[model samples]
Structures are given as C-alpha cells and as structure tokens.
Target: MKSRSQDTAIHALGIDFVELSADRVVMSMAVGPSTHQPAGILHGGASVLLAETAASIASEINIAEKNKYAAVGLEINANHLRSKRDGMVTATATPIHIGRRTMVWDIRITDESDQLICISRCTVAIVEKR
Candidate 1:
C-alpha cells in the first residue's frame, strides 16, 4: 500500500482515473508547465512515466496475498506518434500477458480530441518481500 504522500505524481500532474478495472486502466492528465518540453509540447519522458505509472498501479491493486508483492519495471519501450501542446492527455493500459513472475502491459495515449499521442509497452517483474 502506498501513502497519499507517496502518490504525489498523480496529484502533481492533475491526473484522473476514469476506468480502473481488474486488468485495464484508463487515466487522464492535464498538460502543465512541468510536463512540457523545451519544444513547447508534452515531454516524451512524461508520456513514458504515465504509461509506467498506470501499469504499476494496476499491478499493485492485484496484490492480495499476505506478503507484499512489488512490481519492478524491467523493460519499457514507447513510441511518440504525435505531439500536443497544453492539453489534456488520456492514457489507457491493459495487460498483454500476466504470468507468475512477469507481466507485460500495453498502453495507448491519446489527446482530449482523440488523437494518438504515444504507444508504449512495459514489462514488470514481480517480487515477493519476506
């Protein structure tokens, strides 16, 4: 479980969760000064962070056993399709594969007007804490 203080990234980015089902998650965030690149568009790292965070949150919610299971990102690859300036972006994530020790997630990012912004794939390794 994470404290509210530890989840400041969501608040700092003004992110909202629209759909958070068992295996799928959809979130939106408004573009802010901190999220912009020097080119005046949304930063590439911000998009990747959004995808990574969404996938991690989905995995975290699936933890139900006595021992705490942590999802550590092992691999992530994302491609930027388009650029937007100062607008709300929505990200949707669903698990492509979930195994006992590894999970692969697919994420799609789109702007408020339904334009593709980025696509990402993330892999996480599950670890049990003693």
Candidate 2:
C-alpha cells in the first residue's frame, strides 16, 4: 500500500508514517515552527490533521477491495490535553468500529515523554467509488 506520507499536506506538516496495518496506523510529526501555533505550542489543527489522516488510511486498508470503496472523514473531535513546545509527537490510531457504512477510530497523541498530548475520535464514511 502507498503511504499517505507521500501526500503533499502530510509532507508539508512533517508527518511521517511509522506503521500501517488493517487494525492500526501509527504516525509521528515534529513539533517545530511549522506545527506551532501563535503560542509556540503544537497546534490543535495539526493534531486533528494527524488523527484524521491515520484514521482515514486505516479505514481504507480495512475495507474489502472488492467493494471498491473509499473512506472519507465524516466527523472528528479532538481534546487537547497537554502542550508541548518542541520534540516529536506520535499518534496511534486504532479501530473502534469498522463497518460497511462507517468506521470509527480512536487516536491518541503522545509527546516524547509519553505524556498524553491529545485524544481524538474520527468517523469515516465508506462510499463506493465511481
């Protein structure tokens, strides 16, 4: 499978795909100027982007190829827990639900110290491709 890291947005945000599987997707991004908000901390949008990317990729992999389906983000909610000024943040996404119509993913973002940075849940809709 092609890694989503190759996507321009992912590359621009410095996201790196670490692992890809049907059950889980792992990725990391550096908390540098590019990802920092006005407060010099990691931006919440960056976390959300990471969460959505991981969940979307995992959903695509889990869907049966015969179905010719693609996953699109239906909804996403993120809770920022801690703040980090620098260092890399890693996100791990695991399937909460994988269905024919919809898939839900639970993602947790952690700092270098393994401290919880953000928790997110994303829902993806499976749609048939034209």
Highest lDDT among the candidates is held by which one?
2
Range of the 10 consecutive residues with the lowest summed lDDT in candidate 1: 59-68
TM-scores of all candidate predictions against the true structure:
0.88, 0.92
Error of 1 at 72 (Å): 2.0
Please, what are the lDDT tens digits per residue for candidate 1 over residues 6-30? Answer: 5587777777778887699898888
Q: How close is candidate 1 to the true structure, as a TM-score?
A: 0.88
| Steric clash pairs (candidate 2) | none
lDDT of 2 by residue, 1-130 (tens): 9764566778889888899999989999999899999999999999999999899989988988746889999999999999989999999999999998899999999988899999999999999998
Distance from true location, Cα of 15 in model 1, Å: 2.3
Off by over 4 Å in 1: 1-7, 64-66
lDDT of 1 at 96: 93
